[model samples]
Target: MSTAVKHDDFQLPVMSGYAKESYDLCKAHKLSFQRCAKCKTFRQPPRPLCNKCHSFETEWAPVKGTGKLYAWTIPMNPIGKAWVSYMPYVAAIVELDEGPRMATWVTDVPHDQLKLNMPVKVWYDDLTSEVTVAKFKPA
Candidate 1:
């Protein structure tokens, strides 16, 4: 089962193996994704094999960390007490320059200023000593 850690009342993903590697790289402020070494396909939410070529040959590849805001939504209601503090947060889907879409929170921009296809870049937030969540903001 996937593990989660509680931080400021929020349950965050636990770092292990691929996830660990991703977070470790994020701690160093690097953005990356798993790339199929055989077919040169970049994938997120890292897996052991390529979905397209069905090959186990893969490697963590760094990305340019630039993307366009594909979509977004503001939660009108909090899911739980843990989310109360972030009630007005914006959840967004960013279509990366490499063509992968990442689900992340867009910050540093007002909700009224958000626009479709706006240029954005990845930013890391160290939620804990061992975990850093990727966020996005206007570029």
Candidate 2:
């Protein structure tokens, strides 16, 4: 009955509630956001209530996965041993075309060349059968 998941000393999140719903969409290779059915506002980090109108109704709306690089930082150090090999990686915030911003790894692009508002697109990485994470790259 343990929900803990480990991969090379890195522990994955136990998917549940809204998080599990979000990751489930990623598992299907569809980048989605919870759109407030009342206000039509899309939000990242899915929640049961809408931030705009405080509506409890929402829907999983898929996006084009194309966006602009909102912000980023090159982490010079690893937070965990599992990320030691990935030091100096780009941690970025991507503003999706529909308007929500999501934190993701920006791959295949040098950190020196990254600029605010640069176009990026979503890509999927299957960390496990039930967990598919989204990353981004230069569009």
Candidate 3:
């Protein structure tokens, strides 16, 4: 298998193996999906057990980044010291087209502009050579 060569602009992912697929999807600019074996349901936030049937069989699937805003919140303050720089960022609950909900960062736009029921798509931020975090924002 080939690996991404590092250069002046090369970025790494945050994890490997399990989350590797999500990182790869981000690098490929697609949203990775997780599927439940028992329910045949697609999901995010990769799981080791099927939420629907409590089965241990689960699979990662790819998904289109488009979704509707299921819920949201404007944090009163950033918790960690590093996050202080981007205080008041919107933490959102998105209902994906596949019928699963995802908690991802909303970015690429000002926080004030976010509203319930807004359209959004997947966005990626490369955090390391083996990790890339997924976020969402107005589409």
Candidate 4:
């Protein structure tokens, strides 16, 4: 069998491990991450150093919650039938203003009409009792 992304479980990709700091920032109401103090370039999936310049110095900065639709797809069959309650959903790659791309669901709009390169802004969906994930919609 091909090792392609055939399962629904593979659809929802989030920053884990090295990127935990990214998730933490959203929870704190401050979008932050280690930007190479030397290069001043923003780093995603936060790390002790930079990906381009390999500089170890970094800090947190605010992000504007706005981005463009980098790429996306609509899942015909969402995770579970129950998820169909929130059916006709859209999964997208939103390139945040900070230059890092994040995966999210596009809400408050019809699924079929989702457009490419459309402008969008972040909105948190607090489905979990503890944490809220970022979703996007037309700006």
Q: What local distance difference test score does each model get?
A: 0.80, 0.82, 0.67, 0.67
The better-scoring model by lDDT among 2 and 3 is 2
Best of the two (2, 4) by TM-score:
2
lDDT of each residue in 16-36, candidate 1, tens digit only: 788888788877888778889
Q: Write the per-residue lDDT of candidate 4 for residues 1-139, one digit (tens) a residue.
A: 1011223433242647645566666666565555778888887656787888988888776678888888887766866754554545677888887787777777766656668888898776544333446777889
lDDT of 2 by residue, 1-139 (tens): 1111234467666799888889999989998998998888886777778888999999999999999999888877768887766667788899999999998888887667889999999888787877988888889
Best by TM-score: 2
Model number with the top lDDT:
2
Instruction: Give the CA lDDT, 0 to 100, for residue 20 in model 2.
Output: 89
What are the per-model numbers of colliding residue pairs? 0, 0, 10, 0
> How are the candidates ranked when ordered by TM-score, highest leading?
2, 1, 4, 3
Candidate 4: lDDT over CA atoms?
0.67
Question: Which runs in model 2 stand beyond 4 Å of their true positions?
Answer: 1-8
Off by over 4 Å in 1: 1-7
| Ten-residue stretch with the least lDDT total in model 4 | 1-10
TM-score of each: 0.87, 0.89, 0.70, 0.73
